[model samples]
Target: MRAVRYHEGGDPDVLDLEDIERPDPGRGDVLVEIEAASVNPVDAKFRAAGLPRLPKTTGSDLAGTVVAVGEGVDDYAEGDRVFATGLHTGRFAGGSFAEYAAVPTDLLAHLPEGVSFEHGAAVALVGVTAWRALVHHAGLEPGGTALVHGGNGGVGHVAVGLADALGATPVATARPQYHDALGDLGAGTVLDYGRDDLADAARDATGGADAVLDHMPDTYLGTDVAAAGFGGDIVAIAGDTATFPDVAAARSAELDVHMMSMSNLATHSDAPDIGPILDRIGNLLAEGRLDVTIDRTYGLDEAAEAHRAVLEESFLGKLVVEP
Candidate 1:
């Protein structure tokens, strides 16, 4: 089997494609013949910081067919088409940037018919994150207003559609070039994040946003606080050291703030079951209610270039790797 691995990560250049012995599935696992994997910002971050173990593979999202199943994996069998975010194992055994991956049953879901392998891999992690932020943490309700920062990025784009699907009016912030596209994806209002009047425009859209989905809380925390309605929910998915610029304002408004990461749920023992969420996402994809835009596709050998594009480029949607 061939895989992209980094022995001691420092940059994208550290990724190398090499031939390695194929892995066998362990108990409650299934061996997937990987067809497509998507590059994420986390992949590049981990590549730069280096993993605790040497020579770890570089991707987490994957879609493929099951070639074999291990003991206790009775729900899935040979030839089952599956897609999953594979970072839960914590040992890198489920890395998808390879010809095959051994994924646990708990993290795996049956890919709905008519969903392409590329779309499946592209949406796994980002889709799940957006769904959790808006539907679970934010408690977005029908007819409410949602303010989404970074509305043209991977998770932002999906959040726009999901907010609309849930009957909420979506007010998104993006570059001017993406305004029309965001509107097409169900955003009722799109504002330029660079504009000085961004918060004003957001507030004017719905009096104030009922919920704010923030991707770069480090830079947008104040904007989120200024644009949200009284007692609104603000969910921050990024920014490790994110802080409120005006704690008094947030407190006075009685805003609810939350910080989350998909990796935390993947690794935590007490995390809620994600199987139901994946099933809902798959249903939406199958029914054409949700879409994942593919900005580009790369070969497995060009994984390094894919990593570079994910971090250094401003492409919309996801970059996929077909093995």
Candidate 2:
């Protein structure tokens, strides 16, 4: 099997494509012959900084078919098609950027009947992250307003679409060109993050969004905090501990700031209701209620190039690498 792996972490050059032994499935695992994989920002970060393993293969999203099943695995059989997030449980296992991988059945999900392999690979990680952020963490309601920062990116685009699907009024921030683009995706209004004063723009758009989903915590913590309405929820998927924008503003307004990781430790615990979230997202895709956006695609051998493209921040949506 041909796979991309790195013995040590550093830059994009560290990822090397090599021929390696194909892995066999363990008990309760499924060996998938990968058809496509998507490169995420976290994949690059982990590959460059190193995750839990050395000589690691880094990729989180995949769409593939089962080629072998391990002992006691009944939910899937040989030749079953599927798409899944390899990081749902988070110990790296030669992730999706390869010809084959042995993934625990608990981390796999059945792909919808009509969804394409590229779309499946593109949607899993970002889709689930958006769904959990808005529906579960932010607790968005039909009559409420939500703001999605970086709305042109993978997770942001999905958050905009999903919020609209759930009947919430979505307001997203992006480049000026993306205003009409996101408007088509169900954003009632779009604010250009580069030009507009986000605080003022958000206030005008949805009378100050009740919930704000942010991807750039290093910069937007203050912007989101100021843009939020009283008692609003500001959910962040990135960043470490940082000072509050204005302690007085947060305290006086009673705002809540949620730190979300969407990591294995966060999702895979005694709380077994992951099925409900995945099922809802699956049904949405199955019924065409959820949108799967593939901004670009690359050949399997161009995996390193795909990583570079994503790192350069030139993508409008998910970037997929097809085998």
Candidate 3:
């Protein structure tokens, strides 16, 4: 099988295409013939930050067909179209950059009837992240307001779609060029992060949001704290640390501040399981209630180029590779 592997971490150039033996399915695992895989920040992070093990196949989300299933797996069988997470080594090990991947059953979900392979693969990682943030953590309410920062980002895009699908009013922050696209995706109002009064614009739109989804907490925590309504909740899905403008802002608003990492769900044993939410998203995609835009596609051998594109430029949506 041809897979993109990095022997050592440095730059995007470290990714190389090499023929490796296919992985075998273990107990409760399924061997999938990967049709598509998506490049996420974590895939690039594995390379830039360095890993303890060399020859790491970096990718955690994939859409493919089941070739075979290992013992104790009866819910899925040969020829089942599926998408899964945890590809390489983590809570799940989802190395979907290869032509074939052995995915744990818990992390797998059926690809709904109308969803394409590229979208199915692209949606798993970002969709699950948004799902955990909005549904599990934030409890975004119907007809209530949702303030979404970085609405054009991978997870932010999905968050916009999910917020709309849940019947909530969504106000998003993005560049001027992204306003139309995000509006079409259900963001009630779009504010330019660079030019607009983020806090005031968000406050006026639906009179402040019940929940704020801040993807860039390091820079936007103050904005989130300011935009949130009384008793509102704020969840930061990205960044390791945050600095607030003052304790008074959060204290006066009575905000429920939280830091969320999608990786945490996979790493911790007691974190809420995302398997069922994955299925819920799949159904929404099938019903035409959810959609993701693919910005680009590359093959296994062209992964280096894809990595450079993802890390260097600002693209509108997810990027995928077919192996």
Please report, in order, the local distance difference test score of every candidate based on alpha carbons.
0.87, 0.80, 0.84
What is the per-residue lDDT of model 3 for residues 1-323, given as tens digits with 9 covering 90 to 100?
Answer: 88888888889889888899988889988899999999888788887766636778878789999999999999999999999775645645547789998888878799987799999999998999888888777888788888888888888888999999999988988888999999999999999898657777778885867888987888888888778888888988877677777689789888898788777766677886557778999999999998898988998988888777777777777999999
Please name the candidate that would achieve the greatest lDDT relative to the true structure: 1
Quote model 2's TM-score: 0.94
Candidate 2 residue runs with Cα over 4 Å from true position: 265-276
Return model 1's CA RMSD, one decimal.
Answer: 1.3
**TM-scores, one per candidate:** 0.97, 0.94, 0.96
* lDDT, residue 78, candidate 2: 91
Across residues 75-131, which tens digit of lDDT does each residue of candidate 2 receive? 899988887774523553567788998987766678778887888888888887887
Query: Which is better, 1 or 3, measured by lDDT?
Result: 1
lDDT per residue, candidate 1, 1-323, as tens digits?
99998889798999999898898999988999999999889888888988645678889789999999999888999999988884623644347899999888777699998999999999888888988899889999999999999888888998998899889999999999999999998999999999998878888985788899998998888888999999899999999777678989889889999898877667777776555677788889899988888999999989999999988888678899999
Alpha carbon deviation, residue 13, candidate 2 (Å): 1.4
